[model samples]
Structures are given as structure tokens and as C-alpha cells.
Target: MALSFDGYKLTEIINPNGHCTQIGFTNENEPDVKKRGVILFDRQIRYIEVEEHQKFKRVKVYTTKDAEPMDFDFLEDNYANFDLFLRSIYNQ
Candidate 1:
């Protein structure tokens, strides 16, 4: 499966510091949030990436619309790889 945000395909993860929040909002009446980009991973692997620089567990996943306002803080808190993250999510 593939996920795209604001015309930007979920290709690589962004720096989780002050960069993830760089995504701005639209000028619509309600000011909708616009995403800067997206982080690509497998539904079964749940690895987060920023150019193969790092890998981590998904820990938690949520619909972008209902997720915390531009919060990717979890990206900085977890790092389970080698199929571990994926395995944890499925309990398989």
C-alpha cells in the first residue's frame, strides 16, 4: 500500500526535530493542515525512515486527520528494527 500527503508521496521520513512541523496549513476558511511529506514503510514492517538513516518501530499509528496536531514526537522515542517492530505489532 502507498500513502501520499499534499501531493508529496510518502517517500522518506523527515527530521523529527523542528522539521516535521514545517508543514503549513492551507488558506481555506478552516485553514486545513498541509503535509510537508511522508515517511514510507511497509504495513507489515512498520519501519520509519528518513533516507535509510534510521529505523524504528511504528509503536502507534493513527489516521492523519485525527492524529495530534503535527505531532511526530514518537519518532524520536522508538527504534526497534530487524523486523522486531513489525513482529510486535502483529504478535506473530
Candidate 2:
């Protein structure tokens, strides 16, 4: 699905397991770049970008609420929990 708000256009992609990933882009006609992030839930999102860390390539997950590093496995669990949460809400 697609939504527009606050000068940004957002699109959500739901996998077969019901995990959601969102991509956002500016409302401008010619945007120089588009941004992507993982939306765990309401108000719980992480914006990430590719970076080089310790001579190795990685995607850094940035958050204002915590200083802990979010690795791939942790993010995987978040996605699984989100999928389960959606199922619980819909099954009810």
C-alpha cells in the first residue's frame, strides 16, 4: 500500500509471513534519493543506511531511544514478533 503524509510518500511491502517493510520518498517530483527503513510497529521504526565499520561493510541501525547496536538477528526477531502480533489482532 501507498500513503502520503507530511511531504513524504510511503509504500509498505508485506511478505508472505506478514512482515512489513516500508520505503519512503519525498513528495518532490525529482527526488535525489529514496530512503528505506524497517517499521516494527507504531512509533517503533529504525532508519538504516550502508556504512563501513572496522573495514567491513554493514548497515547501521540508528535509534534515538537506545544506544545498543541492533544486529541482523535482533531485527529478525522483531519482524517475527510483529508478524505474530498482526496474526493475533486479525485472528481475534
Candidate 3:
């Protein structure tokens, strides 16, 4: 599937378990220009370029009450669990 961002074309890589990996940018295409990171979306736009070519960041959550940042937990393969995890993150 085509995922476009700011007129840039993104290639989507789907895992066997149905998770998606959208490659948003590459420094090589810009001829060795130092790139900060890449944009990607799974269930949502959970990232805005990677940090230091390593860390994956989720979209920030804003709520009406005190919410503590929770540790990233890897749930075993299940779409329901995936939805739950994503929902919980946003609810925080």
C-alpha cells in the first residue's frame, strides 16, 4: 500500500503477524545528508522519525488527569492485545 507523507512516497513492509512497517525516509536518497530519523505508523502515527537510528517513539498522550508513563510491554501475538495496548497508551 502507498503511504505518502509531505509528498514523499513511503514503502510499507508488513510483518507476518500483520504489523506494518512504513519506511518514510532515507539519508542515502539525499546523498549522504545526515538524517535525524524516519517517520513510521503502525496502528497510528506512533513515531515521527526515529531517534539516533535506534529508538522508536510513540505519539505523546494528553489527558485531563494525572497519567504516568508506562513501560513498553510486548504483548504476545494477538490483534486484540495489540488494540488494547494502543488504546491504553492513548488513554494515559
Model 1 residue runs over 4 Å out of place are 1-60, 63-82
True-vs-predicted CA distance for residue 9, candidate 1, Å: 25
TM-score for each candidate, following the candidate numbering: 0.20, 0.25, 0.20
Q: Rate the local accuracy (lDDT) of all candidates.
A: 0.31, 0.39, 0.31
Candidate 1 lDDT by residue in tens digits, 1-92:
23323222222232334212112213233345443444322333323332223532222334334332222222333332324333433344
Per residue, candidate 2 scores C-alpha lDDT tens digits across 1-92 of 22223333333334333334343334465466465434543333345545544433333444556554433221332454434433432332
Across 1-92, the per-residue lDDT of candidate 3 in tens digits comes to: 32222322222222323343322233345555433223222454323221121232232322223142212222233334334444433342
Model 2 stretches with alpha carbons more than 4 Å out: 1-39, 53-56, 73-92
Question: What does candidate 3 score on TM?
Answer: 0.20
- Candidate 3 residue spans exceeding 4 A from truth: 1-16, 24-29, 34-41, 45-92
Error of 2 at 6 (Å): 37
**Model 2 lDDT, full chain set:** 0.39
